[model samples]
Target: MTDRIAMIAVDWGTSNRRAWALDSDGRVLAEMGDGEGLLKVDAGGFARSFADFAAPWLTDDRVVPVLMCGMVGSKMGWAEVPYIAAPADLASLSRNLYAIAFDGPARIAIVPGVSCIHDGVPDVMRGEECQVLAVLTQRQMRDACLLLPGTHSKWVQVKDGRLDSFRTYMTGELYNALTSGGTLAQLMEKGEADPEAFRRGLARAREPGSGALPHLLFGVRTLGLFNALPRAGLSSYLSGLLIGTEMRDALAWSTARAVIAVGSPRLLENYRIAAGEFGLAFEAHDNSALLPPALHMIARDAGL
Candidate 1:
């Protein structure tokens, strides 16, 4: 590799695309991104979209190595990079990655996501693996629990710098669905997180039993129906119920040295609060903080 080679790292997700140009020292030289996510771009036009965003940095002498992550590795995106089952390290993931050439003067390599079979169910992830690996690299935490809160909250268990196992919860998606399509939508108002109501719902979810979810959901309607809990707090109540339930279940197998929460501040804060309520110790870091190291690891692993 040339000493002055410009490497680009791309995190292309369902709703957005972010690209960063890095120097040899892993310092960001230029950054560009847009909302032309995989879901928005035409299937055949991915190369064009990427070229449009990366064109200004392209030079005749430069052969940029692009390390991509996110939905770009999915079947609906550019090319399907099949996931490698965990107990995986950076070297192993890079060795198993699937790459393709671009019409432009660049060497493109996409990061393969991770998948694991738990209890006979196949669970998969794309972009979040990069962040988790990045965190592991940065913090040097040998064994830790990684919590990524989003549309599908992921509870990942990494041991000795390798992914051991993980589980996914549809807390955010379910909250959206219930608020938008379910009958609870009419009884709730669009509002911010209500800490008090969230605490109450969390307590309800932590109860010892198998039918906790159904029972709590029943209460969501019954309370509204009987004018027990305030109508405005219904959304927050439901949010807490789902998140709390996830936390309760995850606690059963959370035997890590530390818990690392990654995501936006709002979501991380809620997770932090929930963890505290559950008597768990955790640290929260914004998702962006994990990007640079993640890209660096990807580049190193890809031999860029």
Candidate 2:
């Protein structure tokens, strides 16, 4: 009785995966996901792993189109789908899909990642493109500056509904490394998220001679030691310092006065606050909400 299901769209990342079964009109009939991301998927185990996770929807005996986006298309993922150069649009994305032949009654296609050169260095994005495209199409916008926050955050610029160019920031990863038994780890791990302390870190990053990141980072420890910053506020200050630095540098990546960020509320809050400091209006879209229409659009345009 469930033959109306049209497509299975997956936003699979390195740390998590989510899939939705949608009808032709893009209505979600069921949703499934788990923390067993690409890292846990053993070599050559993607077929079984996908099958197990999609078992419920696959039971209908109909071969539906399964479009996967994110790190699942990376070299370490199920298959290394070649990245298409930037100024990319959904049409190019749909056309460049790498199809995987599965024994299950399903047609699987991996959405290739988008790549571009920034500051004369190569940069790329896998899963975030889906959200970017979703924001573009769903919002019916012709141009905007978009931000996707993560371990490697992205600053994207869209022109005429195409991804013109983008740059990646390792803010999250740096914060993790600094707090993972590193010099600043002890103090940063002691506190709740402190807004004012975070603001201080942000302000410090903008100081006249604060260009040297090492100097600014060392202040995290010294401030705590000197009782200038509280133990319970150290983590927040560190987060602010890094995010503030990222804002100072990345906000110039696009000329748009306002930035639309795609992430959950908790994640977007920091960026929103960062935007206010930099004097830019911030808009937010739920990361999960972007996948369904994005996949459906690609599949439809590709004539799948």
Candidate 3:
């Protein structure tokens, strides 16, 4: 027979949901997920949706304590769990969880997001904060600048194992909007990742000027129109431009000398390359390795 799951770990996001059946020692017993994200979960459907996805593991005749993190805790998600102010550690995060009595026998707790003021500007991160905590703990990083790339990319600074400050970059979403349905959609052509053209875009993004972004973005179309940038390379070039701009700006605010990129392999690769441009060493850790221990730490402290 399979090992008993001691805790149910859930990572619910805007687009997807993943739940892991974890044993007492935080080992994975089984896993399941779906597209029933916050966006798709209708009003009052969160409990039903969660129970359905977790049905297989719920066969045991007991209520399983669920520790969930991500956009599921956002205002638009199941419940509007308030954000935990920044300069916090795992202990603070675990202590401030938002709990709810499920319609069924199970007990559910949502991890609150973290907010910080960097350079007099307020920034917040929901799911990424948990990931950042996991990465810092797993790596035993004392002082590190961490990058989590996504639709809304995050650059977090950790000092002495506590979250000091961070910044959010709209790189991925901007690229998506520009290519998918935005004004520049007509100019971009899908193609394989081209390192050369990508580097060219990165260089363009680094050009010093007052209105460089708009000017450089327009260059993508003009360059393609004049047959300067190949159609097959336009997508990669645009990706480089966006990521490069993010790196160029984010790297300045970060105090750590090297960076740790935490995300998928493809996204990490882009960040690694971008970090190399600024002569910063890059390290990576996937979600699977970083998340399990992180969740356990938080849940345990929360008495879940």
Candidate 4:
């Protein structure tokens, strides 16, 4: 029932937004999701967009606080929530939350992203931190490396319950770029997915003599031209190559022997395959199960 709901947790991304109505213990009571992400918010402003989205849950006889994460707090969002630098923990996220003023009965707050310097290269993540928190806490872990795969994949390290550092890999974005439109895109038209092709690509990534990826990437088309690889399998090959390459470097990037992979099942499947190729072990976790609990934890800590 609506009365049983305590808060609404929104994970607003670039192209989509998903919100959950949760009970006092962070258990889901109801849910809603749509393509109305940050970029798609109506011109009425974020408050309006939020009001429209939460209309179903805001049927409150009592106030239902809203906790949001992701681009909703970025410079382009309702308000720019300054990032909390690493090594960051759950407490830091709660402490640095940015509030949005509204006349609605419930208060609204957006969790700030985290920034870290990994190997002198500055990296930052918006929505993934909450998932990281959930993973660590759910698994009863104080130290672990987490892999959050998506358009921009993140390899995060947590130590003593804090996000020590993380690195971003443009694996998924690059895949889309290559296949969206280009010479490579043309070759993938009739391609059937081939696991062997993917495995071969993964093997190619780990080869010492494969040289730099830029030099090797062109093979996706050449193999097709020579009939050495099927056109339909080229996409799978490209996927394996990129993910395998990420694994090759990421495995070396962190000292953690195994990683906890978090994200949609569809996205994590390829990563799981790549992990197998690298002889690396990983545990898959669905973000949907993790984010709400994490948001609730943040809300509780923020005294919402």
Full-model lDDT for every candidate: 0.83, 0.88, 0.83, 0.88
- What does candidate 1's lDDT look like per residue over 1-304, in tens digits? 2335468788888889888778877887767788988888896988998888888777766577888888899998899998989887788777876777688878888888899998899999898888988888888878889999999999999888898889999999888888897778877876766788888888888877737677788788888899888888887778788989999888886765457899999788878888888888889999976776687777786686
For candidate 2, the per-residue lDDT at 250 reads 82
Highest lDDT model number? 4
Residues 172-200, candidate 2, lDDT per residue (tens digit)?
Answer: 99988988877688765464688998888
* Cα shift from native, residue 295, model 3 (Å): 1.0
Worst lDDT run of 10 residues, candidate 2, spans: 183-192
TM-score of 3: 0.95
- Give per-model TM-scores: 0.94, 0.97, 0.95, 0.96
Clashing pairs in 3: none
lDDT value, residue 136 of candidate 1:
88
Candidate 3 clashes: the total is 0
Candidates 3 and 4 compared by lDDT, better number:
4
Descending-TM-score candidate ranking: 2, 4, 3, 1
**What's the true lDDT of residue 24 in model 4?**
92
Q: After superposition, how far is residue 27 of candidate 1 from its true place, in Å?
A: 1.3
Residue runs of model 2 more than 4 Å from their true location after superposition: none
For residue 185, give model 4's deviation from the true position in Å: 1.1
